[model samples]
Target: MSKIYVLDTNVLLQDPHSIFSFEDNEVVIPAVVLEEVDSKKRYMDEIGRNARHVSKLIDRLRETGRLHERIPLENGGVLRIELNHRSFHQLQEIFVEKTNDNRILAVAKNLSLEEQTKENGRAVILVSKDTLVRVKADALGLQAEDFLSDRVVEVDHIYTGELTLYLNTDLLNRFYEKGELSLSELANHPFYPNQFIVMKDALGTSSSAIGIVDHIGKKVKKLVFNHDHIWGIRPRNAQQSMAFELLLRDDIPLVTLIGKAGTGKTLLALAAGLLQTEDLGKFKKLLVARPIVPVGKDLGYLPGEKQEKLRPWMQPIFDNLEYLFNTKKPGELDAILAGMGSIEVEALTYIRGRSIPEQYIIIDEAQNLTKHEVKTILTRVGDRSKIVLMGDPEQIDHPYLDEYNNGLTYVLEKFKDQKIAGHIKLVKGERSGLAQLAADIL
Candidate 1:
C-alpha cells in the first residue's frame, strides 16, 4: 500500500537524498521544513552543506512541475508540499507555541487525518532525525520514523575483518604443511578479501593457525607480522594483531579500525604511522587530525589561536605519542616534535582543498564524520599517501550519527570488497582491567 511520508527538517539536514529513499511511497514535505532548511542554509557546517544540497534538489524538482501540487518522482512516487489551512487551530494548547516543530507536526496530523479516510486508506509517517520531534509526532497521533538511508548495515552485524574458522584437524594439518589453503577448503564459509582468520581445530585440539585471505580471495596466507613490533608497541590481542597488519601494509592505502574504548585502535595506527615515517621513510610526513566535536554542551568558547586551542582536543593523540616517546619531563615531547619536523597535527576543518601527498595520515574519531566528509578527506590524498581511520563507532560524539550510519561504518562497509582497503573491529580492551569492565557494564 502507498504511504504518505512527511519529511522533517532534521531528516533533510541529516541526509539531503532522503526524499528519494521512500521508494514508491508518496512523500510530503511540510512547508515549515523548507523554512527551517532555509534558515540553516547559510551556515558553514555539515548541516548547512546538506541544507544547500536539498535546496538545489528542490530547485531541480521544481523544473519538472509545481511542488505545491503533486509532482511525479522518478521512483514511481509523487511528492508535494503540505500546509494546514486550519494552521494552529488544530494544534493542541499544551504545545504552547506555534514553533516550527509544532507547525510541522500540525501538517503531519492534518495529513494523517486526510489519508486515513481516503478511498485507498493510505498511511502517513513523519520522518525526522530528531528524537523529540518523533516523540512529539507520536503524541500528536502520527507515525514517525528515523531517516535510515545511510545505515548500510546494523552495528552488531558489521564486518569485523577477522573471523574464526573451525576446520577439521586434517585441514589444519594440510594448512600447516602447505603454508596456504585454497578458498574451496572451507566450502561452507566465505570470506572477504584481506579478511584475517583464526583457523582452529574443530575437534577441540589446541592446534590453531592465523592467516589472512589474499587480495584475490583465492588462498589464505600466514600473517607476515605476527611477531613483529611497530615502534616498540606490540599487538596485545588477536584483533590488534589484525589491525597492525592492515595499518603496516603499504598496499592497503585505506584502513579503518572500529572498537570500544581501550581497544588500542588509535595507538596501533599511531605506532605504525611513526614506524613508516620515521624509520622506513616510506612517507614524507606523519599527519594526525581529528574533528573538533564536543562531548557535552560545548565549553561555548576557548581562548588562543588554532594550534594552541587544539591542544586540549588533541591531547589524546598527544598522550599516545608521549607513551610511544617514553617522555617524562615536560617539553621533551615538544623537543622531539620540533626536531622531527615531519609530524603535523591539525584539525579536520582545515584539511579541505589541500593535496596531501607522501604522508601517513591518521584521522581519529572518524565516527563523528559523515560519508560525504570522509569522501572529501580521502580525495585529498596524493600519491604514496596512506590514510588510517580509527574510531569506536559506538561512541560517536556527533548528535546525528550512530554506529551504523557514521562515516567510519560507511567506509568499512563500502570498501570491504576492495583490495586497497582493509578493516578490523577490536573487541578486547587493553587499556586497563577497570576500563574494560566499565566499558562493558557502564
Candidate 2:
C-alpha cells in the first residue's frame, strides 16, 4: 500500500533529494515548511544552499504539472504542495505557540485525520530530522520517521580498517623470518588491500606478527613503519602504530583517523605532515583545516583580522603543534611557525574551488562536514599530494550530521576497500588518566 510522507523543513534541508526517496509513496510538502525553508534560503551556508536547491527542484517539478494539486512523480509516487493548512487551534493548546514546528505538526495531524476518514487510505507519516518534532508528532497520534537515505553505517559498527586472526604457531615464526605470509595460506580469511592484520600464535601466547595486506603480492607484509618516531612523535598504542604505517606510506594517498578527543588523531597527523613536508620535503606545504561550526553558543562576532579571528577556532591545532614544537615561551611557537613557513592553517570555507597541489592536507574535526563537503575537499587534492581526515564521530558539531552520516565516517566506510586508502579507529585516549575517564564515563 502507498503511504503519504509529510516532510519537515529539516528533512528538506538535510537532503534536497529526499522527496524522490519515498519510492512510490505520496510526498507532501507543507506550506509552513516551505516558509521556513525560504527564510533560510539566504544563509550562505550548507543549509541555505540546500534550501535553494530544494526550491529549484520543486519549481522544476512544476513544469510537469501543478504542484498544489497532485502531480505525477518520476517515481511511481505523486507529489503535492500542501497549501491547505488547517487552523492552529488543534496545536495551540498543546504547543501554546504558532511556531513553524507547531504549524508543521498541525499539518501532519490534519493530514492524518483526513487519511483516517478515507476508505482504503494509506498511512500518513511525518519524516523529520528533529527529534522533538517526531516526539510531538507521536504525542499528537501521527507516525514519524527519521530521514535515513545518507546513513551508511552505525557508529558502533563502523569499519576498524584492521583485523586480527589466530594462526598456527609456525606461521607466525615464518612470517617473522620471511617478513611476509601468503594470503592464500590463510584459507579464505578475506582482507582488503592495505588492511592491517595481526597474526597471533595459535597457542594464544604473546607472540604475533603485525603486517598490512599487499593485494598485488597476495600476502601480508611487515609494516614499513615499526614503532618509529615521526617528527619526534611515536605511536603510544597498537592502533597508533597501525595508523603510523598507513600515514607514512607513499602508496596510500588518503588516510582517515577516527577517535575521541584525546586519542592523538590530530597530533599524529600533524607529526606525519611535519615529517613529510619539513624533513623529507615530500610535499610543498602542510595545510590544516577544520569546519567552523560552533560547539554550543555563538560568540556573535570577534574583533580582528581573518587569522586573528581564527585563533580561537584553531587553538586545538595550535595546541597540538605547540606540544610538537616544544614551545615554552609565549611567542616561541609563533616564531617557529614563521621561520618554517611550510605550515598553513586555513578554514574549510577557503578550501573550496581551489586545487591544492603537492601539499599534505589534514582536515581535522571532519565529522562536522557533509558528504558533499568531503567530496569537494577530496577533489581539491592535486598530484603528489596526500589528504588525511581525522575526527571523532561522537564529537560532531554539525546540526544535521551524525556519526553515520558525517563526512569522516562516510569516507571511512567508502574507502575501506580501496588500495589507496587506509583508516584507523583509535580507541585509546592518551591525553591523561582524567581525560580517559571523562571520555569513557562522562
Candidate 3:
C-alpha cells in the first residue's frame, strides 16, 4: 500500500522538489506550512529565495490538477493541501502553547488514526528538519523522519578531498629516480586531480615524499615565496600541507578545503594566493569573497556602495589579511592592496554574468551556500583562473542547510574521485590553545 508523507515547512524550504520525492506515495502539505512559506517568501536572502521558489513550484503543479483537493502528480503520487487539521485542540493536552509545531503534530496524529480504521491502512510519516518536532512525533506514537534528500553523505564518512594511495617499493623508487611517473599507473590510486601525494613506504618510516600533479602528466612545482610570518602562521598539521599543494597548483583550477573553525583554511588559501600572484607572477590578482549571510538580519536594505556594504560580513577576510601583512596602522594593508591592484574582496551576490580570468579566487564560508548557488559560482570561472572554496561544515548559518546538504559537502562528495579538484579536512584548531579546547569540549 502507498504511504502518506506529511511534509514540514523546513523540509519544503530545504528542497522545493521534496513534494515529488515520495514517488508513488501520497504527499500531504499542512495548511500551516503554507502560512510559514508565505512569510518566508518575502525574504531576499537564500532562505527567502527558496521559499519563493517552492511557492512557484507548487503553483505550477496546481495547473495539472486541484491542489486544495487531491492532485495527481506525474510520478504516480497524489499531492494535497490539508486545511481540515488546522486546529490545535487535539494536541493542547500535551503542548499548552498551541504553537505551530503542536498544530502540525495534531494533523499527523489525526491522519494516522483515520488511516488505521481502513483496510490496508497507509502509514503516515511526518518529515521535518527540526529536532524538537521529530521528538514530539515520537512521543505521540506517529512516525517521523528527517528529510535526507539533501544529505550527500554520512557526517563521519564525508570526503576529505585528499586520498593517499600507497605505492609499491619499485614505484616509489622510480618516482624519486625519474622525478615523474605515468598517469595510467595511478588508475586505481583513488586520487582526484590536483590532489597532493605523500608517497609513504608500507613498511612505515621516513617523512614520506610530498608532491602535487595534474591528471594529464603536468607537475605543479611547490611555491618558493618567503614567509613573512606576519599572521603568526604555520602549517600546524598534515592537512595544511595538502592544502598548500592545491593552493600552489595553477593547473588545478578548482580547490576545496573543509574544516572546523581556526584550522587556518581561509588564512592558508589567502597566503598561498598572495605568494602565487604577488611573489611568483603566476596569476594576475588575488580575489576573496563569500556569501553575505547576516547572522540574524537581512542585508537587502543596507545602504552603501558594494564594498562598504560588504565590509561588515567580509571583516573576517580582512582580519586574515591584516594579520598576514603585520601592519601596525589600520589603513596600511589597504594601501598595499590598492597599490598593486592585486587583491580584491567582494561579495558573491554580484558574481553572476562576470567573466573572471587569470586570477586566483577564494570563496570563503562556502558551506552556507546551496548546490545551485555553488554551481552558479563555478560556472563563471574563466580560462587560466583557479577558484578555491573553503568552509567549516559544522559552522553553517543557512537556516535550511545541514552538514550533508550544503554546497561544500556536495562538491566534496560529488567530485571526490574526479581530477581538477582537491580537498582536505583540517582536524586541528591552530588559532589558540583555548580555541582548540573549545572546539573539543563545546
C-alpha RMSD in Å of predicted model 1 compared with the true structure: 1.5
| Candidates 1 and 3, the one with greater lDDT | 1
Q: With candidate 2 superimposed using the best TM-score fit, by how many Å does residue 352's alpha carbon deviate from the native?
A: 1.4
lDDT for model 1, on a 0 to 1 scale? 0.89
lDDT of each: 0.89, 0.89, 0.82
lDDT of 3 at 296: 67
- If ranked by TM-score, best first, what sequence of candidates would result? 2, 1, 3
lDDT for 301 in candidate 2 is 91
Instruction: Give lDDT for model 3.
Output: 0.82
Clashing pairs in 1: none
lDDT per residue as tens, model 1, 1-442 = 8888988888888888888888898999988888889999998999899999999999999999998998899988888987553377668675879888888888888777777787888888988888999999888878998887879794468888988889999889888998899978776677889998899999898999888899998899887675476788988988888888898898899999988999998889899999889999999999999999989878767799877889988999999999999999998998999999999998999989999999999999999999999999999999999999989888988878888999988999999999898988999999999999999999
lDDT of 2 by residue, 242-309 (tens): 98888889999999999887989998999989988999999999999998989899997989999999
- Candidate with more favorable, higher TM-score: 1 or 3: 1
Candidate 1, backbone clash total? 0
Tell me the deviation in Å of residue 151 in model 1.
1.0
TM-scores, each model vs. reference: 0.96, 0.97, 0.88
